[model samples]
Structures are given as structure tokens and as C-alpha cells.
Target chain A: MSDTARDRILERLRNAPRQEAPRPDAPASTAADPDRGARVGRLKSLLEAMRTEVHVLPAAEWIPRLREVLQARAIKTLLYAPETGLGAALAEARQQDAAGLPELVAYSETVESFKERIFAVDAAVTTAAGAVADTGALILRPTRAEPRLMSLVPPVHIAVLAAEAIHPSLSEAMQDGRWSADMPTNLLLISGPSKTADIELTLAFGVHGPKELIVFILDD
Target chain B: MANEPFENNVDRALADAQLRKNFAFAMGNFILKRRAVFSDAEQTERLRTIGHAIKQRALSRLPELLEQLEAACTRNGIRVHWAETTAVGNRIVLEIIESHAAARVVKGKSMVSEEMHLNAFLANHGIEAIETDLGEFIIQLNGETPSHIIVPAIHKNKAQIAQIFHEKVAGAPYTEEVAELNAIARNTLRRKFYEAGIGLSGVNFAVAETGTLCLVENEGNGRMCTTVPPVHIAVMGLEKVVERLEDLPPLLRLLTGSATGQLVTTYVNLITSPRREGEKDGPQEVHLVILDNGRSRIYQDPQLRQTLQCVRCGTCLNHCPVYTRIGGHAYGFVYPGPIGKILTPQVEGLEKAGTLAFASSLCGACEEVCPVKIPIPALLRRLRDESYSSAPESSVPGRGCKQNWAERLAWKGWAFLNTHPRLNRLTTALLGLVGDYLPPAGPLERWMRYRSEPKFAPRSLHRRIREEGIADE
Candidate 1:
């Protein structure tokens, strides 16, 4: 009585009159557009429309540039995963710029113990696994080293995306292996800051996730 | 609330002027937003066709896909359960929570849970289910059902929300500022996210091949609910499954483009399972509850199966003039607008929800803007047909059981009169004797008088002209 529902449902579906639609063409992960450069430009404008501040810079200048950005914003503390490449660069920068421009906190402890402190942090930076140019979305494939909360809990989120990893469409990103069989437990695509229009249809940002989403696109 | 009939609900909703205005304004914005993103008409048509095909295929292959999804999810360490009815679905959810000994649960927006009244069930069983979505949270506090699918509290303006906050929310001051009100909810729910022991969410699309649950949301609460808790449970209708992971792209494109006019929602979480060995923060245990309720019955009829193609985009609601005029709660069920006009009777028993069939204007606006092209007006007509259909209940037969006497007689009279042109003209001429355009006597007559052309002009102009020999000029 408690569990026969599954069998009953399956049985019903099994007996449903068969109507099959032709399978869709295999997904193409890369943008079908002839002008790849224009897609990136279009992506930038779209992201900007969503109120996300976008920066397109070369790989060599990413760390120095991020340092300039952090100092410019006057963010008191920055949280990052030490295992990531960007995390290592930040660690080196923090040691060199040790005049308390921005305190760098390494997320080495378990989240359960440091949950409160994690919330109090001003900003967190993570490296995006891939991005969709059409939607201007950055994909965060959460791993143990760079946990899911880093991009989610903080008020400000700064993500670094490889220019080459940007796909023409979401379908292309998935078909091209950004989201595969052996993918992480959770894969997140962030289009902009957390927002809601529930209060009288007036749009307001930063309800639960980051208030500001700053993406650094590195053209290597 | 669920048991109230549609007629009663519609009357009450129509009497509320503020609710009508909110629906008109919000639905108008939604229309413009959805249209803006699909500027390329040809591409939009291509996607609509693809979306329709994908849904058709999924519904046709539902049994196989459900099995594959269950098997794949189990392999990925996610537990799977099923419920044939809303009550069973609630009981199953309670049983899962009972096992966890969880007290407080945080939930993202799940219309299926609303369908099951799972929050009420959980409360009855001594567990609290908190809706983290701001719109849902407001409706929950107000002790009202959601008025709109996308904007649940669309019926309330800032002043009303501010008043609710002042009265209900702890330490909240009376402020009609939208930003401040959002902040109050954010601060209040932020604490709940960390304290809640379990989280529940709805699935946007469940992939069969990889056994993933895809969710689209603009706010981060979905992320909080799925990730922050130790235990996570997801509930979805059986029709929400898709065959392949790649099939998601086109469906998602259509869904988001039609929903809020975004290229994509702010957040699209693809969850495969609970936390693995190395994951630092995520649910330790995950569960997926697949519900049947009455969806299987809908699938039995191939024509009606198209109703299941809805991606819950709410575009049809935005485009539906009738829905915009009267607003959501008037439909008197979990879903509202054109889709609800058809779906309510199908799921809740056509006999129980039969009046919903009459709620539509039979306008094709919903069908026209439907990303998946569900023949909504036709389906509504089918339900209307079922309501008045004289077929007796048979276990082997279809959805509705009741027969409407007046409707049957009216159709009979229409058939008889239309077949005999002499009688039809005689009756028309006799009615025309009531002074060409007499004042409408009643609601039915008022509508009839306006819709019908004035009795055939005394004599045809062609005959008069030919007789007078002025036709050549």
C-alpha cells in the first residue's frame, strides 16, 4: 500500500499509447555563428544588461588586474580556495601587498565549523569551468577544493572565465563536455546576482546569493 | 481552500479591483520581456517546434525514461520514491523526514508540493516547512494560495506587503520601500538556511541518461536549499523527465525565453546526487520523489497528452486576456490561467473541477504564444465537451462522467434549427419582430444580442438594385 504507487504509475505509462517524436539533432556545443568574436562582445553587453560588471583582460595581467580591482573597491576581506590556480595567485599577491589592502582568507577548514565566518566575508573568487556566451552565464562545477558556498554565500562574487571556454549556447556547453557523465555532484550556471521581483513586480537584487557578480574573462 | 469550486473563486477574484490591476500590469511586462528575447521570429519558431517534439517524445516514452532515470539516479547515490496521489506524495515526504528526525525544512518554490499541500501536511505532522522564495514566503505568511505561477504574491502591492511585514515579520518596521522589504526577507531567511535540517525543491527537468535534476531560478534560495542542508529531497511529476541530457538545451531555451524573457535564468543548478567523498558542502542524503496523481490519466489520451508539454513557463498566462482580466486565484486550483483552465479538471477529476472548463474565453492567445504549441483552446473545448457529455461512468472509458441537461437540450435545439433553413429563418424573423435591436434582457441575451448581426436587412441590396436597373452604375 505504501509503495505500490511506483509500479502502478510505471504500468500506466507503459500502457500509454505510443507516440514518438523524431530525436533532435545531436547537440552542438560550439556556437554555430560564423563570428565567434562577436558572440563574446554580445555576451558582454548582455551580462552588462543584467547589471554584472564585466572585464575582458589577457591572462598575464589577470592577477595584477584583480589586485587593482580589489584595492579599488576597498573590499576588506577576500575568501578563496587555495587549491585553484587563481587562489594561488591571490595568496602570492596578498603576501606581497601586505599593507592590509584586503585581508585574504584561505578556505582550509570544513564549512560546517566556519559557516558564520564564511558569511561575514566580503567577497569570494572562483574559477569558472565554462561559460555560455549567449546568456553570459559562468559555470561553476563545484569541487571539494573550491566548494559550492564560495560562489553562493558571499555578498560579492568574482569569477574568472577562460575566454576559450565560452560556448555559443548552453546546449553546446553540455554537448562539448563541460557537463559530462563524471561531472561534479553539483554544476551551477550563474547569470547574474540573486534577484527577485516579488515585491510588487519591482526588481531588486541580492536577495540570497551575491549582491554583485564580477566576471574576469581572460583571453589567453 | 482546495475544495472550493471554481465559480465561487472566480466571482471573488473578479470583485477585487487591485488583483485585476496587478495581473494586467505584471502580465503585460511578462509579454514584452518574452517578446524581446525572441526577436528572431524564425529561430523562435524553430525552437518552438523542437520544444513541442521533445515534450511529445518524453510523454510517449515516459515509462522507459522513468525507469532509466530511477536506475541512473540510484547508481549515482540518489534515492528515488513515487506517489500515485497527492496524499501519498505528502505521506512519502513525511516518512522521509520522519526517518531523518528533521524538524525544520527549507523549501524552494515547488508547484507540485503546492499540489500535494505538503507544507500543510508537514505542519500537521509537527515539522515546519519554510518557503524561501520571497513570493511563496509572503503568500505563506498571509495564509493565501499563490495568485500567479511566477509571481506568487502578484496580487499584493508594496504598501500591502509592507503592512504584512510590519504585522508579521519580527522586528520589521512598516516601510513600503521595495528594496528594504527584500532586505528584510533576505536577512530573515538567511538565518533559516543555516538552521534548517532538510531542504526540498522542484525539478525543472529530470534527465534520464545522467539522472540529473535541473532547476532554474533567479534567486539564490534554490542554491541555498539544495546545498546548505544535510538532507535534500526533490519532487516532480512523472511527465517532467527527458530522454537525454542534451535534450535539455532546447527545452531550457524555450522555457526561460518564454518565462521571464531571459536568455537564461540567473541560476541553473544541475544536481546529480548528494555530496560525494570529497565535497565540502552539500546534502549528505538526497531523494527524488516522482508523483503520478492524475498525470497518467491525461497521458492515456494522446490529444490531451499535449497538456503535459508545458514547461511551466507561464507565457500562456501572460498572453491570456481572460487570465489577465480575472487573475490567477479565480481558477481555484494549484495552477492558473489557460493551462490551469485545462489542467485543473484533468488532474482533480473533471467532475470535481468541471466548472473550470467555462473559465476561458476560447481565445487563441495562449496557444499562439505557447513555446511548445499546446492546443489549449481545443483542450479546453474537450474538457467543456466532457462536462456536458452524457456518457455514463465506465472503468474502460475516459475522464469526465457527468451530463449537463440544459447544454444537451441547447445543442439539440441548435442542431434541429440549423438543419431546417426554413424554420431557422422563420424563428430569426420572429425574433427580429422584437424590435431589431431590443435592449438586452439578461446576461446571456446581452452577449447574444451583441455578438449576432442585426436581422437580415429587410431585403437584399442586390435585388433592389437589379430591380431598379442601377446595378451597372
Candidate 2:
């Protein structure tokens, strides 16, 4: 049934008279900024405007900052992917934590195995593929280790972005990463925490996804 | 109410002062926000032009692009389904759900699904289809469709929404506070996301190059719906396909900036496939349902094809005076406002939706604010013509269904009188003598309802010209 429907639809589309609109001229190109600091500044302001808490720190201090923020927010259970480099570092940090750090829960198994536990998790930590300064968006290419829901599902999402990886815009980030050529199974450009202005156009945060998004910009 | 006369719906909507106030307040904010983001007129126009071109380019190669999109998605292990009608689309979705023995569906914001009336279809089949988008969830609870595209429940104020939540939701307290309402919904639907057998979403942009289904949403519900469930099914109008991944940025920029004046939506998800091996999360199976749903017929006409270029931004509705006054419900369809005026008639047939074309004041505000430059006013004018045209060449479905002999004869007589110089002159002279004394009655009654009857000149222009020794030519 679907095959016949498909064939008929395609045939109808093919048989339809072609509508010729004026061919669009190439888009006006904004000059890519050569300065990295400008990109970082733009990303910070944009993210801050959208109510994302952004902390730029030396690589050596991100762990301490993450620990402090988690403690401040009273987060108890932290979810982390077990295989990624950042996850390994977080595991190492948890091993050496004196006190006040949240309980580190490694997502070592399939989500079905720990769905309830993960939903009850206070926070989740993951590494960003890159960042777009124009929109203050974190580009996440979820992989086997850093699964899609690590940055979602939890009440809070703490993503680690390298300062050197921030690009001028989404187009620049896509081009720099050559994403189109070898795209990941899932790629997301998340600008802020889950938000909605649906009810009477009033803004509300953390409707379904993580209410709080904390981005640690590693300056190392 | 979908079959109600357009004028009747408008009258009912106008009578509701609260609905009018809600629309005015909401549209005012939207208009201001859009203006602030696109402050630079030149830059905004350039972006609109690029966005327009990309849509046009993609549409020009639509058939090939759809094929490429199918192949690309298939290569990525994403199943692609085609449906010529909404019924077929609904059946395809049902089959997918029943295959997995899943009866619960958590749906993200999808206008196409609404057009399919998928929720009702699923309900009839004894399946639970829950709306996850905050706005959509509210309206679904009230047994109503979306009043606005971006903001589905824009017609309801906070008080009304609080009442709906308090009444419909079990153990939910009445709260007019936005944050509390959001939290209530979050706690309510969050579990549904994890428990649902299937997650359904509308595709914003279906990229052909990388075979990606892009979804833009502010709330995490969309991400949750596409990620948490084991099976993810996305439905899109066939025209949603873009030729390349690079075409996304400008279009995304225009869409967000124009839709709600956001620099970017909170989440822009690009799903190329379902969960990969060893992945701990994300949907295991991904299905993309491509629905034509009268779009192919609309594409047959060169001029009318512009309708497909819409990106579902409600800026046109925000700028439309008629829409602001009447709200979206007055249009009585899944889509409402200026875009709906043209789209519904064409899709549902002129016989059913022809009155929508005449609902517009033709102020051209819709076209001016349109991100893709879809000449909405011009399209509305064309639909109006198609409604009256008994011509065989008319492509719109149910064309000439509205052609009444009395109206046609009146127009024809007027045209005849104007075409002949002597007849026109005599009519004008006769009108000069009695036009001032003519009562505000008959066809002119509606026109004079809002204003006093106009006083005619003592002499006709041609006669005055001759008396003043001016050339009559």
C-alpha cells in the first residue's frame, strides 16, 4: 500500500509543472573574525543573556569549580559517561574528592538498565564537540561514550567546552568541524537550559529537560 | 466549528474581549521582539533574501531532493515512509506503533500531525497520544487546537490556563504563576517521555545532503521526546526538505529571529539516525514520514507553489491586523492567520475553505513580515480569483464552487458599463443626479455600517472637465 502511494506521490510531484522562482544570489558573507577572544566574549554574553551560567577557568581549576557549583546547588547524584576523556578526569576527581562533591554515577550500562536511577540523578556532565559564539550554542555530537541523554534527562547539565574550540557562528563551526562530510548520528546545538515562553508569553526554565545548564570553558 | 462560516467564526472571536486582549498583548510582544532582533533593516532584508533563495532553490529540485533525502536517511538506518493523504500517514504511524506493541505515544510539537489529526486517530484506535510541548499540552487538555503556530495556546491567558490545569490534571493545584505551571507540566509529562513506546516530532528542516532531520525547540520536551523513547517517528510536509546542510544556518537564523525574536532556540537537534551500537541513550529506531497532503497539487501551479516556502514562523500572523483582531481560532483550521488563509483553502478545497481567502483585509503586512517573502497577500488575491473563476484553467480544488450567478452578473454588468465610454458617461451623469439621494441600503449597506454615506459631486468628472475647458481625453 505504501509503495503504491509513494510511487503515485513521486509521480505526481514529477508530473507537476515546474515553478521557476528567481535564483537566489549568494548570501552576504560576514567576515570571519580572526581574534579568538572576541568569539569567547560574544559566546559569554549571548549565553548569559539566555540565563546559562558560564564559568571561564583555567583547565586546572574547572574540576574545583564544578565541585563547588554542584555543592552550591545541593546536587547529590552526578551522572557522567564512563569512557570519555572528561569523564575519566571527573572519575579521577571523584576518587580524590575530600568532601562535599556529589556522588559520581558512571553511565556504564544501557539507559534501560538504570532509567529510574538516572532520572533521579541531580546532574549530568558531558564534553561539548564545539561552541558557536554567534548564538552561544554548545555543539554536542553524542557518541557511544557520551550518549545523547547524558546532557538531557537529568535535572542539571554541566558541559565542558574548550576555549580554543569556540567558533564565530554555527556555519563556521560546521565548516571548521567538516560536519557535513562525516556527521555524527546525533548533533545538537543547545543555546541555553530548557526554556519556554508558551504560557502567556511568560518565560519559564527547565520545563522538561535540565533546568540548569552550567558550561565550564577550559582555558588551558 | 471547522466547517463554520468564516464570518461567523470571526464574529464569535471578536465578541470574546479576553481572546482579543490575549492576542493583542501576545502579538505586541512578538512584534517588538522581532523588531529588536532584526533592528538593522538592511541586514534583515539580506537575510530574508538569502532564506527566500534557499527555499526556492530547494523547492526547484524538490522531487530530486526528496529522493536524495530518502536515500540519505535510509543509508543512515532511518526508515522513510511516504503518504499521499493524512489517512495514509495516520495508518503508517499506527502500523509502526503496533509493530512494537506500543500503545503510548509522547508527541512533541508537530503541526503536520495536527493536520493528520493523529491524536484523534490514535484515540479512536485505543492508543494514548500525549502532547509534550507545553503549549500543545495545554490546548490538548482543553480539547482545542493551537491558536498560534509558535505559541499554540496563545489565546488563553494565565488564569484560563490555570483553570484548565487545575480541572484536567489530577492532584494539580490552580496556579497562575508561569514557573509553577511549567513545573507542574514538567513533573507531569517527564515520566511520559520515558514510558512512551514511541516519540513523535515534526521535522523543521529535513536536510538532503547529510540526511538529517532538524528540530528546533525551546523546551527540552522535543529533545526528550526524540531522545528518551525507544522509537522516534518524525513527520514532515514534503516541502520541508532542504538541499544542503549549509542551507540551514541562514534559514535557522531567519526562522528564530522572525518567529519569537530569539538569537537561537534553546535546542536545535540534528538527528541523522537512531541510537548507534553501544549508545546508552537516544531512540533505537528512527522513522521519517514524508507527507504530500495536497502539497503536490499546490506545487502544480507556479504562483501558488510559493505557499510551500513557509517555515512555520508566525510573524505573518503577528503583523496581520485581521489576525490580531480575530485570533487564529476564527480561521477554523490547524493553521490559522494569513498563511492559513491561503494554505487551508488550497489543501481542504475551495468549497470548504474558500471563505478564508476573503477574511484578510489585504493590507500586505503578512508579506512584509514574512521571513521567506511568501507573497501572502498576492496568494490570497489569487485564491479569491480562483473562488470566483469558473475557468477550466483554474488549478485550485473546488474552484468556481463559490461562483454565484447573481454576483457574477453584477460584476459583469459593471464591467460592461465601464468598458463602453458612452455607457459609462451616461451612468456617471445619472449617478451625479441621484447618487447623493441614494439610501445606504442593498449591497452598500455593509459598507455604510461603519461610516456615513458619501455625497456625490454635482457634476461628473468628464462633464466638469469639458465645462472647465479641459481636454476630456
Q: Pick the candidate with the highest DockQ.
A: 2
Residue B99 deviation, candidate 1, in Å? 1.5
The TM-score, computed over Cα atoms with residue i paired to residue i, of candidate 2 is 0.97
Instruction: Give the per-residue lDDT of model 2 (tens digit) for B164-212.
Output: 9999999999999999999999999988987998999999999999999
Cα displacement (Å) at residue B180, model 1: 0.8
Q: Which stretches of candidate 1 lie above 4 Å from their native place?
A: A1-3, A26-36, A99-101, B1-5, B391-473
Per-candidate DockQ values are 0.73, 0.79
The global C-alpha lDDT for each of the candidates, from Candidate 1 onward, is 0.85, 0.90
Model 1 complex DockQ against the native: 0.73
lDDT of 2 at A176: 80
For model 2, state the Cα shift of residue B459 in Å: 1.7
Query: All candidates: CA RMSD in angstroms?
Result: 3.4, 1.8
